[model samples]
Target chain A: MRRTPPEKPADYLPIAFPAAMLGLFFVVPFAIMVAISFFERVQGGFYQPAFTLANYGRFLSAFFGEILVFSLFLAALVSAVCLVLGVPFTYLLTKLSRRVQVAWLIGLLGVLSLSEVIIGFAWSTLLSRTAGISNLFVALGLMQQPRAWTPGFAAVMTGLVYQAFPYTVLVLYPAFSRLDPSLGEAARTLGASPLRAFLTVIVPALRKTLIATFIIVFIFALGAYLLPQILGRPQHWTLSVLVTDQAIYQSNMPFAAAMAVFLVIASLVLVLLANMINRREPAS
Target chain B: MSGRFLSRVFFAALALFLALPLVVIAGVALNEKKTLAFPPQGLSADWYLQIFTDDAWRAALVHSVLIAASSALISVAIAAPLAWFLWRRVAPWARIVQVLGLSPFILPPVITALGALSFWATIGLYGQPWTVVISHGIFFVSLPLVTITLGFATIDREIIEAGTTMGADDRTLLKTIVFPLIRPYLISGFAFAFVLSLNEYIVAYMTIGFTLETIPIKIFNALRYGYTPTMASVSVFFVLVAVTVFGLVARFGDLPKLLGAWDEGER
Candidate 1:
């Protein structure tokens, strides 16, 4: 073998600690839990290390299928909602003067800066009865009572939309801001109608960014914790919530690991698919 | 004109939607009534005071800060070397290790939580504060790494040569030149990791369960039993802290540059 050139070395001690931490705390424990799922519980919540897919088979439970489908629906819904709300502003912001663009960027940065937990707490109070600004519909005599927003599906949608929209907007903003605006204007000057110009020229220009935003938001909504935790009812759970309940409450290590593994696999698929689609995108 | 109107309304509604929650949480914190209420009957600071007197809340708050600071330091320490590798190494195994280092962070929290839960259990480190700090550090590794990488990438190649010709070794060049240039970015990245670790509830929850609760977990538990005005007071306190921190950041740092979404060189 040819000799390699000498170089300045990286600090192995620094990387070692975190890698070991991930291995010990994150990788190994999950491995044990996954291993346990196959065997029936023996004692002290420990299962004799035995291999069977029977526990995985239990995922055929109607609840598992139902939750999985509902989670997909919610993910798609949240992604679509964020896309709808995000696209126009991203376009408009890009079109605006730089000063205005920075103002909006700063605002979006603030929203994204706050933690997801705080965002959940904030929305819960906003939609809660009596004082929730949403409840003002009742006070104004537009409705009879404060809509049962939280601990329900509607609130789950609201929370997911809230959690992921800023991300969608932030990501898509750059693609829009850096877009070649003259192309769209040229299309208009060439006698294309406004909608047609947008549809044909602007749409294709934005196609990759939209796809990236959609995939990111969908995966994010799929794995969301606090939004659904605070907003959704107990039975109407996301895979994240369901896995959490299983691990912490039921102490069903194997089952929880199974669900968590499923979530990871699903996220990986979505992200990879997005990457493939993005790579296939043509130069604008 | 209609398109402009539509766009304006879209952003207006979005702004309202984002602001609404903070407003209510602050309002609820001021309720004079004992139970958590909307349209609180009157105003009071009792709940805010309660946060000070409550021992459990105090302990959780202290725990959160300690972990967040420790985790930030740990993340920076880890990131520095990783950034060095990413900046220098192009070898295949080196690349794989790089991805592995970031996998837990780039992936979702739920997946990381699941992995960490199992990872911690076997090592008998599952519920310790150190475990929480370590988990947090792992989760936020990419932020500091990316920031420092940016800081490193921006350093003109000639500067390193300039130092080397002055007879400086790698260590001296790094300490004397590289560190000073990236220090602000390092601080911002560290702050980002610190805030995120402090606010992260799910990882802490799955790993720690009730063995120890961070302030967010404590608040979550409190809400499960029943919402209290004191909870609102805590929310308000967080807002105050955010405002105070941002104010200091504005004073000591260029807010726009720190965010990393834009460049200082850009208009």
Candidate 2:
């Protein structure tokens, strides 16, 4: 059956409703944020209407620079860890029976539903001196005493990685499941060891997916606000924590907006890059 | 094979790592003491009872439910029409709309929250519950958009032609054909958005703050000021809620398809 494309009048209602909603709520606000970043910070925790580059200039400080660098590093680390752990787990997942796979997928979805705040505190309790892994170690005679591990980098990383691991698996699962098992079989028929066949065949095949997963997880970890604040010390606070601190607590909306603009730009670039990679290999 | 054994061991250990914190929280929620402990001094449901009976926790629970329900409705309302239009006609403007709609979610919540803060303040809507509702609706519209798009993909073109041959208008076709076929996706999308909004924190904090206390914010404050078994109990409540919602989606809908794990093209 030949069908005609819907005409202009018909298109107006569908396009206009969502467009208006997004424009007013999403795009315009971002524009306003960018505009506010240029406004002057004035007395009494308010900003003046006068245009200035003062907020962006404040980002030039070494302290803000350190925070931004540390955030990128932390996000990179989390993404790397998720990829390292997720790839093998997903590989094993694809090898499972269909029913078992569904069960595990549902379990991962349930974990993914947990809010960062909840995960952070859950890990904090798990890492606390009173009833943490250290206590288990002591019970096993592996340690002399329980140790307080919260408000530290390791604890923060654990929380962030736990929050991100599900995402990494979900993202990679579709690609891995779609892969032909015969590819590995074909390699093994040529006398390649199982490890060698996997490394040489599957690893190369999922290269783009691996990079995409890394960037996705990296961006997610970069935007983390509650986790770092809950699980780590002041020095470990990410760029997100600083943005909220400056905006709400410090009452420096302009500076906060400026930092936020920077954060958005960084995220935007990574997302666009990922999109491009996905486009380049649409099948993957 | 050694490789198979290694994979099994590695997967088991990682799964345990993922489940450990949740298991510990559930254990601690049964503590008889105020302080959190794993080998709880004594097992009791006092913390759970406290969550159910305490005024602050009860109010927060109610508020969270209200906000999540409203936001999920708004998201599906917006996403349904948008998905319908895009599926019917692949207009250039539709591509732009799709990007704009989904970008809020792709970008960090902090950025969107900052934008919402500035925009709401400018329009004098700050500290209002509706601001958070609208913000969350925009943030999570992507979930329904993706689901509904997949739903639309499943409709055979011939079915649309058949409806047209019967002289059914677009609205009639949608009501008679599209809605019924896409109903599960719509429900799944709603459940997805509801669960996510329940878990959302930064945007809620930035937009509504103390003006309205949602569960996440309440739990966050509790954790920051001090650790308590009450907070652990709240976390348990959240886990249970998430499981229940997703469980329904899995039971009634195609969870793998909703997750985009199953390719229609392949079939």
- lDDT (tens digit, per residue) of candidate 1 on A1-284: 11123343543444455466556545665566566557564545654567777668877999889988988899899999899888876776667765566565555655665666677777777777756765678779888777656778888898888778877887676566556668889999999976678779887777886887798888878878767878778766888888777777777777777777777778888878887877877644
Supply DockQ values for each candidate. 0.44, 0.69
Best by DockQ: 2
**Residue-wise C-alpha lDDT for candidate 1, range B1-267, written one tens digit per residue:** 786677678778888887677777877878888755677679888888887888877788888889889988877887777666556445445555556556666466877787777777766677776787877887787778767777777677688778888999768977998788878768767876776776788888877866887877877887778677776777667656655554554556655444443452553
**Which lDDT tens digits does candidate 2 get at residues B170-267?**
88998999899999999999998999999998889989986998999988888768777877888888888888888888888878777767654573
TM-score of 1: 0.89
Candidate 1: residue A128 lDDT (0-100) = 73
- RMSD of every candidate to native, in Å, equals 3.5, 1.6
**Which is the leading candidate under lDDT?**
2
Per-residue accuracy of model 2 over A171-252 as CA lDDT, tens digit each: 8988888887888899989999978887899888888888877898899889888889889999999999999999999999
